[model samples]
Target: MDKAKVLETRRLLAFIAVFEEGSFTAAAARMGMAQPALSIAISKLEAQLGTPLLIREPRGVKATAAGLLLSQRAYEIIGLIESTVEEVATVEQHPTGEVAIGLPSSTAAVLAIPLVERLAKTYPGIRLRLVESFSGYLWDWLLNGHIDIAVVFNQASRPEIISTPFAWEKMHLIGKALPGEANAPIEAGQLTGLPMVMPSRKQSFRDTIEHHIQKQGGTLDVQIEIDAGHQLIKLICSGRFYSILSPGSVAHEISTGQLQARPLAQPLERAICLAQRRLRHQATAVRCVTDELLSEARALIVAGVWDARIEAPLCT
Candidate 1:
């Protein structure tokens, strides 16, 4: 590349840092340069463009209208450069790197083990790191680039994220059954006064459940709040409280007859989403592990182990 072109690219990066941070000192520190040097670079950039890109203010600086347009274009240019470099580096690659994935506790309970096994067997060079939390945390991690991939529930629209529908799981009423009692579907109205063990308010699925119940003129009498899915299930199994969960969440207990699950008369379902950062470059290792995850989920759904309907086919 030409020397002038290289300097222009550097100036663009400097402008982006200052524009986002809104402070020359912070942007200078972020770029590992002296504050004076960063300011001079920005001045030179403005002079070259024949316009003022930013206005100095008491707090720091604010972008001019022209500056905003340049910042947006700069991001596109930088993103394209980064993705191009990563793609070229992966040519003839054996995918030897770590890929971090986030999953909600409910999905991780069943999907984690199989995903690990498949990756180890098929792509030994690819190391897998799993972070388990609720869907809300998982969404944050995915957007902030803390994780390469995530399995979330009913993800909302966001420009930074690219999510695909994985499945739709039907919610059920789960609790310990009385002796000689037959498990039957429960009416939505019947949950009005049910003493339920529920997830914390921060959890997205908790809001989904609340919305459904409230829509039916029912309110949950929550006796306990537990964030961890496994612990919540344990509390429910003690025969002290009931919870609304998907069959997949309590598949083991349901199979062993330790806990019985009753479907709702009017089905309530939640979407399982596979999410990733929209602008981040997808490396070979990341793509390989994502494929393995999709395959494992498909196999589980097909074998009737996870009681969910596939919303879309796996990505190739």
Candidate 2:
């Protein structure tokens, strides 16, 4: 079988939809196709690959390991194709292209607005798509061709992910106002006793926090684990539990006087970077977006819009 025929976009998308929806009937409904047609597509794909991807259960269906792997890669494949088409259609003067950027919630809160505003004014023809996720997933998306660029707190040790230093972000311990000491810096040793909520271990930031605590002869007293950034910010605003985060993640709450934050006595810092896929054809639109992100972020820092410090190699 020809390799090109083996990985048809339609079939890959169909299989991924089924894998996500967990049933051909449901996937087909979501995709606006007949259930039998969806099933046939999946079967044809399996035949071409010479492997069974679906394990039909009593109630619905589940993807086998192979199916899951393909589903993950399929996202990248489809995204790359879309980006390539858009890039080719884009012009230099009237650069009309779409750039997909994955940013952590912290960075997204601070950079997304300014970046969008700048791009809108500078290159109105360019379209921007912002995705917020933990650093680990962002790294994977960058590697797998799911995103054009990423502004991440921590980068993965992948040679294929080209990174340029963006800035140094200071982490904070945020929650209810302390008893008569609202401005007091929270000590690392004391953090082991505070009830906290943070991202799950799947997120690289959580591990970074834990590693910092352990190095300081303490540990995170995490009461709950959640991966969503908005929920974590909501928890900080609730004041019921304390969480380690950057001020940028909850800038609205902090600015509105709805929340209070203090830097750790032993400040925890993470280096943020602008990462792109190495050895891949990078679109000019993508480069323009990346440049805009750095510029906006630096301006925000200098203007105190974001409580982060700009590090070396600030531009490009």
- Overall local distance difference test of candidate 2: 0.79
Error of 1 at 304 (Å): 0.9
Best by lDDT: 1
Model 1 bad stretches (over 4 Å): 1-83, 178-183, 312-316
Clashing pairs for model 1 are none
lDDT per residue for candidate 2 within 113-154, as digits (tens), equals: 788888899989788888988877887787666887887766
Q: Which regions of candidate 2 deviate over 4 angstroms?
A: 1-92, 279-281, 312-316
Q: List the residue pairs that clash in candidate 2.
A: none
Candidate 1, 81-177: lDDT as tens digits: 6556766876676667778899888888778888888889999888888999888888877765689889998886453456888788989889886
